[model samples]
Target: MNVAVSNNTTQPAPRVIKHRAWGRFKRNKMAVVGLVIMVALILLALFAPLIATHDPAEQDLLQRLKPPSKEHWFGTDDLGRDLFSRVLYGARVSLSVGIFSVLFNVIIGVIVGSIAGYYGGKTDSILMRFVDMMLAFPQFFLLIAVVTLFKPSLFNIIVVFVVFGWMGKSRLLRGQIMSVKNREYVDAARTIGMSDFRIIFVHILPNAIAPVIVSATLQMGGMILSESTLSFLGLGIQPPFASWGNILQSAQNLTVMTKAPWVPIIPGFMIFLTIMCFNFIGDGLRNAFDSR
Candidate 1:
């Protein structure tokens, strides 16, 4: 009886950490719903070439300002462009802006942060001061100024956002790396004469990346909003290319709003829902990654 009890006690527990994380995420009903909605939106955007009925840029002045009907689902805009088609196509622009801007920021941030944190002296001070200098500037004004100087192209918008967007992330990642660099594994790697480059990239970065991933997720939504704001202000994506922001810009006239409220309403709702979904997913990811 004693031997059997000892054997039972010594039995290894079933491995369930991944399962637990997944279970926790699944249990968060809001997160699950957000995930589903986001996935659906992505699919809708991806297959838009097949699904969208009208050419996004085609204008039919004769059909201009028509209300939603069997022919044009979300109604026609001032130029008689299909609002539904524009909105569907706009998703691609908005999502691309968000994704590319975030990617650019993350790359720059991770590299700067890893170097600053791992080296930790004059390098850290100089890098952090630069980050501070960036923060001191009014982000929106700076972005507008930059975009105005360079022609307002989609690529230019992405670049401008990336330039301003990296500072906060760099600071966050610096703090995370500072905490992680002091771990025993890192010290052991150093002791074993691992090249600093290898140690930082192979060891430190993987551990530090989790928080950065969460931040990136949240930042994506902000990037989308920023892009929309810029586009609404007539400085992003340009005409012939529709985005939710550009759609809103077209509907800015009071008369237009009164006559064709759905013009702004549909795009506005999409922006709101997309951002909310990203935020919820980011929160859920943060909780999942929290070691405690």
Candidate 2:
């Protein structure tokens, strides 16, 4: 009877990785806006076939050079293709190139960087020097040079982008891993006789991956721009395929630039919008991951 009643209090649950990251991300207003716009663009691209009123590649010489109107929301291009439909389809190409190229670049970079960083001395020296050698080349020049050597198709262009893009990310993750490899948890894992692979992949990478995530997000816009640049130069995503860059290729003509300004403006704005949104989201992720 004298034992008295015990107090009952609920403990707060731990925050999830995604929830925590999202909480931090939403704090940035510009990032939230960027996320919204990015999602909308992605959806627009995904549903282009259904949303598009006309065939993106179908040409009608009679409708060519028409300005924005009820019949054609973005009007018609020089080929008399519906600009609105082409723009939507272009989003799929540009976005896919950006995403796939960046993904492969990050995977290769992370693997190379992790191996070099975890196993130091000669391994680090050789790998870091190789990265430096790759970096010494002017990236754009190198990109153009390599791209010119291959067939100008979507797959070839992505492969070329991946080849050049990994160097920076490798250097970034290598530095991050070096900083993190000596931490106490890593030492603890080592003390327990954990395999080198597990220690690096499981213990070390989770902590070091923040910078890589930020780097990858920031690089997306650049990747998209690079793809666009190549397409503009006729070195990527050949004709009949809609891409923001190839769409803008029309503006190279003075007549088209003067008479059908919408041809370039629409794609140009799309590129600008996509890049800014990616940058905003990158900044948000950087802030979100920053514990300070």
- Over 4 Å off in model 1, which ranges? 1-23
Q: What's model 1's TM-score?
A: 0.90
Candidate 1 Cα RMSD after full superposition onto the native fold (Å): 5.4
Cα misplacement distance, residue 203 of candidate 1 (Å) = 1.6
Model 2 global lDDT (CA atoms, 0 to 1): 0.87
Per-prediction TM-score:
0.90, 0.91
lDDT of each: 0.86, 0.87
Which digits, one per residue and each the tens of the lDDT, describe model 1 over residues 1-292? Answer: 5544543454222234345657777877777888899888888888888989899999999998899999999999989999999999899888888889999899999999999998899999999999999899999998988998889888898888888999887888899889878766677677768999998888778767778888998888998899899999998878888899999999998877898888889999999999999899888878876657
Best by lDDT: 2
Q: lDDT of candidate 1 vs native?
A: 0.86
- In each prediction, how many residue pairs overlap at the backbone (N, C-alpha, C within less than 3 A)? 0, 0
Model 2 clash pairs are: none
Q: Name the runs in model 2 displaced over 4 angstroms.
A: 1-18
The alpha-carbon deviation from the true structure for residue 169 of candidate 1, after best TM-score superposition, in angstroms, is 1.2
